[model samples]
Target: MSRYLLVVPPLAGHVNPSLGLGQALVRAGHEVAWCGPELHLRPLLGAGATVFPTGSRLFRPQSDHGLAAVRSVWDRFIVPYARFSLPAVDKAIAEFRPDALVVDQHCPAGAIAAHRLGLPWATLACSTMDLGDPLAVLPRVHEWVLGRVRHIWDKAGMPADEYFDLRFSPHLVLATTSRELVGRDFPEHFRLVGPLLAERPDQPGFPAGWLRPDRRRVLVSTGTLADDVSARFLRAAVAALAPLGDRLQAVFVAPPAELPDLPEHLLAQARVPMLDLLPHLDLVVSHGGLNTVCESLAHGVPLVVAPIRHDQPINANQVEHAGAGLRIGFARAGAADIRAAVTTVLGDPGFRVAAARVAESFARAGGTGAAVAALARLTESPVTTGPSRSTS
Candidate 1:
């Protein structure tokens, strides 16, 4: 069994996919160790992998401004991550002496550490990393922001451009997203592995009186990161769907802290696993997160997406282009708009059919198990120099 060290950003969306792949690796008779914050320990351990806590920082909201929030991810999360976690990863590499390093796409520290330690490394991209065509324009924006942040890193005595270079470069890059949205010529090393989702271990009992009811069941979730903004949208959606109360049941998977006062007609719960809930769902209202989008599609549930930031808008665009969903801009969305989007999706049976077709495609693409096999191949051959392309 080869020893593998997986380093991931502490965000749930970023970490969850890696955890799914790590579990598959463990089941295949490989030893997997995850180095991240303490919050990830339980889930990583539950997945049958060893966990090493590296950074003490928790992922808290860094800004209230919309686009500024995206920049905060780099300043508060990425910069600190590179600074604090590199030493920990370097130390772990020295002692564990892993056969290969599997890192999250954004974690340049892991990739560089593996290079310095002379071990093979690969990147598991949770979202779109290839910044070409529509995405190509992002580098100029990223560079502008990095130029400002570089000074901080320089003050901290870290090589900022070196880290950025490592982050933008990868030996092999695997994205959970499909090519439907990413355009063509996406680099030979980039592989579109269908979304890596952990198979749900059975959870006991559904919400009390949570019957399928007479109307179509629509699951509304915003994922963990954007739950606050999602909650506001849910409230608007619930208000819009109030008239269709008996005709449509809206289930909002809210965080306990942000759970809004809901009308008795609409069901509200904190932290219901979407994997366990999707089978019963006819449609989903979501933020177009990669995991949520892929999971809903995997379950053959049509979507009404409200994209806020990052790759969400891109994912929403893909869903709409594929005829599986409708994308609504969150910045301009209102009760009427949310209601109209939901009605349009539910009213048209074509959306459901398209969703099912995509679901079939995703099933054929292979999920976490395929990712595990891919990693194992990397371990056996050990791409020690330059970028290696994904044959998929």
Candidate 2:
């Protein structure tokens, strides 16, 4: 048996994947603990999990698009969070004495701490952003991010000559995607373990009976994190789906506050058991988040994606390129455009066929079980001292 510590951010998308991996480790007779903000972790992890709390802060909210969004993430959140969490991570390592650490790509402090202590650690690539270097086309923007990373590295008092990108682990990298969707080759160290989808806590009181046998089922969600563009896009979605009431039923993952005047055929809720509901869905209208997109494809459900910010555009493009979905402009798409995209995905049998192909690829790549074996391998390997480069 080995002890594994997961260093993660407060955000749901980042922490959710680790839940399955951590649970699998425990089930395999290993000890697992988390290092993150307790407020968010407690609910998601339940009462039994051990957590080394890192507290919380009011970082700047990301609400921009394109290059601005990329800059906002690094300048406002990632860099500052790294500086703030480094000490806590070091402290966790001191007390827990974990055999290996599993760090998320977004939390560079975890990797830095592991390197400082000569501990074996693995990187968790939860999205497509870090995998293909998608921002390589924008040279200046890419350099700007590197500069921010250097700032954190220098502040940690590490040797300037041994500078390495802390976002990637030297030993192993677990990506929550498949090569079929990535559409590219990856390094041997990088394991494309598909989505780590464990059974999440159920969101009770969902009127499952509301789903009608006569109408096709569609789920419209922009994800948990709210943005400036989501409000307008959701309103447009409501208008688009309202007219198709007779043919299909649309369920929006929106609170009553967001849409007070929802019609009879449309349902609005603050939360729904997404994993539990995906099997029943025929089509998904999404903001192109990796989790939602992969989950939809994993269940062989087609999609109509409107990318909002960050890595969403890339994920949406991957969906379209794979022939599993269609992409529409998030900022410019109106009711007609959204309705047209949704209708096209549902009308085309080819889209469903493509989705099934992606699902098969995900199944072949394996999910939580593959990730568990990778982490176990890391724990068994010798812990190397100092900074070393791994294919990122």
Candidate 3:
């Protein structure tokens, strides 16, 4: 039994996977707590878990990427986030005295703080962006990010030049997705722990019986972070599904009050426990959020991905490459394109087969259970090895 701290950002996508890991760790007889924003975390994590209010608004859910999303993430978000959170994490360290830290890769502040304290930490890769090494091919982009990491080390007042790559952990790096979804070429130091699958904390009463028994059931969501992009896609989706009439029914994740009137066959909700809803769905049309994509695959439900920003385009490309779904341009795809893509996924059995095939891999990856074991091992024997060079 050890006391472990989870350092994370307040973003829903990042926190969701960590929640699964927390749940698994607790069940395994370890004491677990978190460091992030209490306001956003309470509803998701519940009052049982202790949370330290060290989070900053360094993360934006939606960005126009006028500055380019990657550059914005490093320059505007990650660097500033780490700079401000250093003291807060120091306070937590003094009070909690955690044995090890489970840190989200995006929250470099936690990583720097853990390193300064000489505490063992594990880098949790909730998304494929880091594991895939997307920027490695671009020499200039790679150096640019490295330079930012260097600046943060100096600005945060930590031993300058002591830490260069905060994205990786010296002890261990755990990826929540399996090789089946992300492909085999991941950093050797990184362990593929699969998606930390947990039941949605906001499990709303679902109208499972309401789905028309005759029609193909579809789930339409843009994830919580994408309001504007989703609104546009929802409007287009409404038009695309209109022709199906009684042949198809769609349930949307949205604000009921803000949503425009939709067809009778379509229902809008502020939120629903996706884990609860996935079982009833034949197909999912998503904004390519990692949680939604992995959850859909875990249930053997195919997807139709329309990417908006950030890591979504890469995720969409992976889904398309895996033959689990079709990809469409988020901003450019019209109603006709939406309808055709959904129809293609539904009519073809290959898509479902592909999804099922990945589902098997997800189950075998051991998910949170394996993740817990890896983190526990870190405490028993401190890891001195550097990160693995993965070109995949």
Whole-structure CA lDDT of model 3? 0.82
- The local distance difference test score of each candidate is 0.72, 0.88, 0.82
- What lDDT tens digits, residue by residue, belong to model 1 across residues 65-105? 34565567667777767777888888878778899888886
TM-score for candidate 1, please give it. Answer: 0.86
- Where's the lowest-lDDT run of ten residues in candidate 3? 383-392
Candidate 3 per-residue C-alpha lDDT over 196-314 given as tens digits, one digit per residue, 9 for 90 to 100: 98655656887767877788999889877545666777889888998887678988888776567777888888888788778878999998978889989989999999987777887
Q: 1-392, model 2: which lDDT tens digit per residue?
A: 99998999887888888888888888889999999888888878778889998888888777887888888888898888898888888888888989999999989999888886678899998878777788889888778878888899999887787778877787999999999999999888898989888656544467868999998899999987576579899999999999998899989998879888888999998888888888989999998888889989999999999988888999999999999999999898999999999899889999999999999999999888898998888888786654344422
Clash pairs, candidate 1, are 131-136, 132-136
Give candidate 2 misplaced runs (Cα > 4 Å).
386-392
Estimate TM-scores for all models.
0.86, 0.96, 0.93
Clashing pairs in 3: 176-194
Query: In order, how many clashes per candidate?
Result: 2, 0, 1
Q: After superposition, how far is residue 126 of candidate 2 from its true place, in Å?
A: 0.8
